[model samples]
Target: EGIFELEYLDLEIGRCRILEPVKVKMVVAKTKEGFTVGGFVKTALEHPCTRCLKPVRLEINGVVEALYLPKNLASFKREKRLETLKNVIYYTGNIVDLSERIIEAIVVEIPQKVLCKPDCKGLCPYCGIDLNEHPDHVCDKISQESDIDPRFSVLMNLKKNEEEG
Candidate 1:
């Protein structure tokens, strides 16, 4: 039962940025295999919105869990089992390294799709203008052209079914 505040963590995920200190609370217990570490992690991440390209800050809370195995066990049958498992780390010395486990915990909690707002209008396809700011925006070229795509023109007559008459 301990609390640790990490100023920053070295991670690269596109335009994502860690906006606040990473706070971790973990409990380590000695197990037959080695050690079991479980904790909670909290942090804030800033990422560009998917549609509008706006910076959006989101709070992340993740649960950390991992199994630490000794290097001596690597030579035996247990090593083969470790390869198929998730959140497992092999260590040699007395000091256990938790960096890899901590990063994994945080990453799993990150959201796949992030948006500034629920109904973000996004950008106009033709002009690349932020639609949220200008909802009524219209492109003259698109309006002048035929609304239907030529490739799908044959499907238009399927609705009338002239042969039925």
Candidate 2:
């Protein structure tokens, strides 16, 4: 059982920036086949909110687990090898570098839909106004356009036919 601490400065994960030095805790253990490496990383990031495009600060925590393959394994079919060892990582020499796996783990923690808050109102498509800033704001198109959806246009003429008859 071994422990290691890795710290990074100003690391960029996708479009977000790490605000401070982030530390990742690595735990390595010897296994029958090879070695197992597992770790957890925590950091604070600043990026534009997906909804309103406002700068928002978020805390991200990521966990990584990988199985290091031994160098003396027999060669097999590429497809069979990939299927059998989907999560296994192969190392050429004595040392195994986990930096790429750590970065991948952290990046996977990023949410697909990022918002300033849980119920953040997005910007207005017509006027380009932040709905969060003006909750009561209304666009002129709301009054001019019909409330009926375009998909329901066929049903609209039924009401007119009944009124005329």
Candidate 3:
């Protein structure tokens, strides 16, 4: 059985949950050359939407394959085993902790900005208001006709005369 535990970080990930126990399946096979362990990893977790702060669920599935080379001077620098060594998570003769690994996977899966819906009406740039709830807000459509620069008024008159001609 695989066991993992995680402590909460104070940062607002919004809301999230870990749904299932992490499953690590391993198999050892012996051939004329050597033995290797290869299998799959299954993990499930939840994340929160960055925009409206809603929970989003996720599942991670991956494979793990490593060659068990003898820890001896003769086989110390096997080139073929380099790939396996790079991918494998090594542990000293002690219980391996999956907590950090699980957290890492979850963090990697989180979207930079998660919207509640595809067409989410985000906050108004001018007023810093959420347009979703107050669709009827009149401030959005109140066009500022006075934004024109006073120095440009003579240019506007000149343009109008040119159009008339």
Candidate 4:
């Protein structure tokens, strides 16, 4: 087991930046076919909230698992190694690069919807004022009106009747 420091890697997440070096702990096992590496990674990233546009810092934790085989294995049985096992990396010589697989592991752990807080009120659609800062701020024209299109009023009435009943 060892701690690996991942530095200055670009993840291409929208408006997001890695806050620090990724902390990773890994263990390697030798298999008859190849090598198996498994580990966990932890880090934090900062991005704008999807709703409020406030800077949101989120802690990200992910797992890393990969299989590595010698480059010569790819030619076995007419390139059969490439088709059989999923996510197998063939490496030449003694060096194995884990950077790409590490990035993939982190990408899957990222939340689809990033929010500053669970109860973030977000920005007002009419005036663009941050609703979290002023929960009671109501637009004169917006409060008394339903912004839903008239074509969807039938669906709205159905919801209202369902709630009342």
Candidate 5:
């Protein structure tokens, strides 16, 4: 059993970044073949909202569970790598680093559509201002009444020629 503090900068998870040191508590149980580790990691992440583009702070609490196999045992059988443990993570030395596995667990849990709130007003296409901030925001109205579909261009030209003739 052990506690470790991981402080890293510029660690990017998707488009998010860890703003501080991550706390991890782990317990290792020795097995005949290898060792199994179970723990939890806690940290904070900053990411831009997918809709509003506003910076959103997210609290990450992820459970970490991984199996470590020695180099010889890991390399002896290639099939065992996948068949033995579905979530087995390989390590070389006596020290098993669960950082990579922990990171993977957290990243996978992040949702594809990360919005700041359930109802987020996105930015305006013309002025690029946040619509949420200015509910009454309006842009120059460009009329598309005279615009003709390109697919009907030939018919439009023939009608124009007939009217002019």
Candidate 6:
């Protein structure tokens, strides 16, 4: 079943189809001036979070629109052409392949980084352990004595002598 529907005056040039159920919505329209088409896409696919290696869900949504104009008028001069064309797609033939356009919109909407949750407790760097499940884990702690470097021992002795004096 299609996630969205398109009521087209001419079904020959345009039609609607759902690539992935509940994830993608495709619409195609054939106009006298040209062909206009668009789609709404979404994905809840699992991916590893950059901060934590835990699995996270990603959701994407976007709209893709295109227009098919006559080949002769393809080079029509218009201010802010690229920006205008971004919202209005151009085509030179009767049929426009909207697969790439729709996919591109969806791809751009995808998040660069996926987080498992807002406050995900990342893994412990020292022990290489997942901190989310083990809030009380203390194996990664460093002893106060062990944390002191030998180079600071001289400084500590000098400070002690000054205090005693």
Best lDDT goes to which candidate? 4
lDDT of the structure predicted as candidate 3: 0.56
lDDT, candidate 5, 5-94, per-residue tens: 544323343456677667677778997778888888777778788878887877877788777777776666566445866787666766
Instruction: Give the local distance difference test score of model 4.
Output: 0.77
TM-score to native of every candidate shown = 0.71, 0.66, 0.47, 0.65, 0.69, 0.53
Model 3 bad stretches (over 4 Å): 2-46, 57-80, 84-86, 136-165
lDDT of 6 by residue, 1-165 (tens): 154332211222222233333455666677775666666765444456666677555555676666656666557775464456755655565566655665566556656755688788788766767778887877635334465588887877897799999
Clashes of 3: 0
Tens digit per residue, CA lDDT, model 2, 74-111 = 36444564467557877778888887876777677877
lDDT of candidate 6 vs native? Answer: 0.59
Of 2 and 6, the candidate ahead on TM-score is: 2
Q: Using TM-score as the measure, which candidate wins?
A: 1
In model 4, pairs of residues that clash are: none
lDDT score for residue 129 of model 3: 66
Worst 10 residues of 3 by lDDT: 6-15
RMSD of each: 5.3, 5.8, 7.1, 5.6, 5.8, 10.3
Model 4 weakest 10-residue run by lDDT: 1-10
lDDT of 2: 0.72
The total of clashing pairs for model 5 equals 0
Candidate 2 residue spans exceeding 4 A from truth: 1-14, 71-74, 77-86, 140-165
Q: Candidate 1 on 1-165: residue-level lDDT in tens?
A: 344455444545464677887778899999888998899988887777878878898888889888888877767875566777787777888897676666777777767777899899898877789999999988665653376587866765664476555
Worst 10 residues of 2 by lDDT: 1-10
The alpha-carbon lDDT assigned to residue 31 of candidate 3 equals: 44
What stretches of model 1 exceed 4 Å from their correct place?
Answer: 1-13, 79-85, 140-165
Inter-residue clash pairs, candidate 3: none
**Model 3: per-residue lDDT, tens digit, 1-165?**
354453232236544666776676556676444455666556665655455445556665755555444435234555665554654444443344444444554465556766767766766656756676776656643355365467987877797799999
